[model samples]
Target: MEDRKLTVRSVERALDILLCFTRNDDLGLTEIAVQIGLHKSTVHRLLSTLEERGFVIRDAATEKYRLGMKIWELSTHLSRSDDPAILLLPAMERVRDHLGETVSLYLREGKERLRIQAVQSNQAIRRVAQVGARLPLYVGASSKVLVAFASTEEQEALLNDPEWPSWIDRVSYMEQLYEIRECGYAMSFEEREPGAAAISVPIANCHGVVTAALSVSGPVNRLSIDTLYEYAPYLMEAAHDMGLMIQ
Candidate 1:
């Protein structure tokens, strides 16, 4: 009766055991088996494997099981540039309210960039970015930040890609990356879309790797250097908070 084509039973049962502990701080072997409608022996076997891998930890005194730091470690890496919309959407909404501009979360894909998340301004007319919108990594505030923090090999390959001419010469590009690294952000003014401007800050993981970018964008008149600089701290703070949530 099981749908073997679409599901793997052992993995499903293991996940079930994991989910049981979510509602209860810790669960005994019998309780987990009861919760998942599985036999005690089966649940114990699954927990043995999980505990061995550090996915779950068993209390020495009580023998009850709880999620482990391994879960946190895996979750940290799982918070990719495009995923974790639940955390990113609300954070970006806060940024939009503070800056009165559209806030976007961008991720890199090969030589291109994608706006995976966004919160648009309430104004009748404001800069807007549809989720999953693609842009060139060589332009735009978010794109530049993603590129500036990209892995060296990725940066090299993108810089040399022939689909588009280099945005800047290698010497200047390197210098710009250094500047962005020092400043902890990047900005663009009417560089991509006419009359639009944006500023972006990097979101780094606990490992200090830049994984995503948070950007505020609007009409050039409103998103000026002064305004963007003013919101830079808030943007950076939001990015940091979001990063911590991943860990």
Candidate 2:
């Protein structure tokens, strides 16, 4: 027998479910059900209702579900509402267009990394990441850029966890942070994923606190270390401009 039962389905639960969608760009029925800890049938029914209400939709081509146009339209109204992505997108677009690669905006959530926005190039071989994707702290160039700026206490805290990712050690991450600060940008070659390379520049608030980062990524073949060095100045320029714009 179930020891406890939910007496009512409140609006808060629905909203919490909606918020989960913001952590991931797309999810299938089973994935959503598992994440929300609900029965598959219940999740399916809720998703159908959400789809009818225009909060979500299923992509026939990929058979995956994602937030719908309505969400995007509604989100646009709040785009500038205390979120850096609003001010970052325009500058990000300029860099993306100039570099012909994928651009992303990232923010730190506690010790994790969150994607605030992403724009994939129209080019055939463009790299892409879901807008709401969350990744471990040591996953990629942008994530490491943010992590490198984290406080020593925070770094120590993460280091104490035995489950931390394999590639990042606290001492090494700290060293890399100093180098990134000295150079004004971060670059990595296939560190996070095979064949993916990226360059990142930190975004700061008016107080000069690092709040977010802007990055451009592409296949390693196309964005070699030498070329990434060549592109570093542009990324720094864009991040600086966007930070001022956000302020």
Q: Against the true structure, whose lDDT is highest?
A: 1
Candidate 1 overall Cα lDDT vs. reference?
0.84
Residue 226's C-alpha lDDT in candidate 2?
A: 94
What lDDT would candidate 2 get against the real structure? 0.80
Candidate 1 lDDT for residue 36? 93
After superposition, the stretches of candidate 1 with alpha carbons farther than 4 Å from their true spots are 1-82
Question: What TM-score does each of the candidates earn?
Answer: 0.65, 0.76
lDDT (Cα atoms) of all candidates against the true structure = 0.84, 0.80
**Inter-residue clash pairs, candidate 2:** none
Candidate 1 per-residue lDDT over residues 111-150, each given as its tens digit: 7777778899998879977876778787788888998898
Q: For candidate 2, lDDT tens digit of each residue in 118-218?
A: 98887898788788788877668887788777787877777677778666666777788788878888888887778899999888877778889888999
